[model samples]
Target: AQSVTQPDIHITVSEGASLELRCNYSYGATPYLFWYVQSPGQGLQLLLKYFSGDTLVQGIKGFEAEFKRSQSSFNLRKPSVHWSDAAEYFCAVGARASGGSYIPTFGRGTSLIVHP
Candidate 1:
């Protein structure tokens, strides 16, 4: 199955601290990588994506990730934390399947707890 997995279900980060959320994917030929953030049950906002070129990709809201083909991993990182950043983060894989559009397979999700 073309899927993505996020091992961490929950993470707590202090305000103004650093943050890193891990992500791994199972896909052939280096699928599109994306990191999305959602507030509770709300819609997901695309944080970043790695489609073709650059191994190191930057995204909105001061986030960046590196695609490591050898390790089959794309990890999301942020230099500093904000209380508003507290939300559920999901790693996804976008792929074409049998004439259907390339859609994302989301992770179970990691809930970020920002402590003030």
Candidate 2:
């Protein structure tokens, strides 16, 4: 069985400040990892994905994440966050059942609050 857990339910940061969101997953084999941002009332947009190779992956909107195999974690980071980035962020892992077939599973989501 594969499962993802995001410790934070919400976060607040000032505009232009750095941001980091935590994520943890449980799986037997290395699974696909992804970060998605969803604006109010909108669907999720892929920020980045770690399928294979390169533990450190860059994503859209100047976001990046580093995969730690031993820790069973993939955490998202941004140097400077914009107000537009103040939305809900979800950390997910692609899980498969018995075979190669996989489905996307998301965390509870962290609501980002950008203080003006």
Candidate 3:
């Protein structure tokens, strides 16, 4: 069974500062990576996803992630974070199952705090 690990439970960054959230996955074969953000009282919004092709993939809201096979990591980054970006970020890893559907494993989640 594969699992996802988000090292940081909470991360604080000043508004307009660069932000990076760490995500590591344990899987034998190639896996899928997904980043999602959930604001207060809002549904989870997909920030980015990496299935294949590019190692560095751009996402919505000026976010991007790089998939490093050697490191078994898919880290999400934003050059300048906004105060509205404060939310709970989740890292998920999916693998193809016998039925050709993907089974996703999610990390506990990392809370982002924005400072003035």
Best model number under TM-score? 3
What would you estimate as the lDDT of candidate 2? 0.93
Alpha-carbon lDDT of model 1: 0.92
TM-score of 3: 0.96
Clashes of 2: 0
Q: Which candidate should be chosen as best, given lDDT against the real structure?
A: 3
* lDDT: worst 10-residue window of model 2: 95-104
Question: How close is every model to the real structure, measured as TM-score?
Answer: 0.94, 0.94, 0.96
Ranked by TM-score from best down, the candidates are 3, 2, 1
TM-score of 1: 0.94
Please give the lDDT score at residue 6 for candidate 1. 94
lDDT per residue as tens, model 2, 1-116: 78899999989999999999999998888789999999988999999999999999999989999999999999999999999999999998998756767787889999999998
lDDT of 3 by residue, 3-113 (tens): 999999999999999999999999988899999999989988999999999899999999999999999999999999999999999999998889889988899999999
Residue 32 CA displacement from its true place in model 1, Å: 0.5
**Cα distance off (Å), candidate 1, residue 13:** 0.9
Question: How far out, in Å, is residue 102 in model 3?
Answer: 0.7
lDDT of 1 by residue, 1-116 (tens): 68888999999999999999999999986688999999976999999999999899999999999999888899999999999999999999998767866878998999999999
> Each candidate: RMSD to true structure?
1.3, 1.4, 0.9
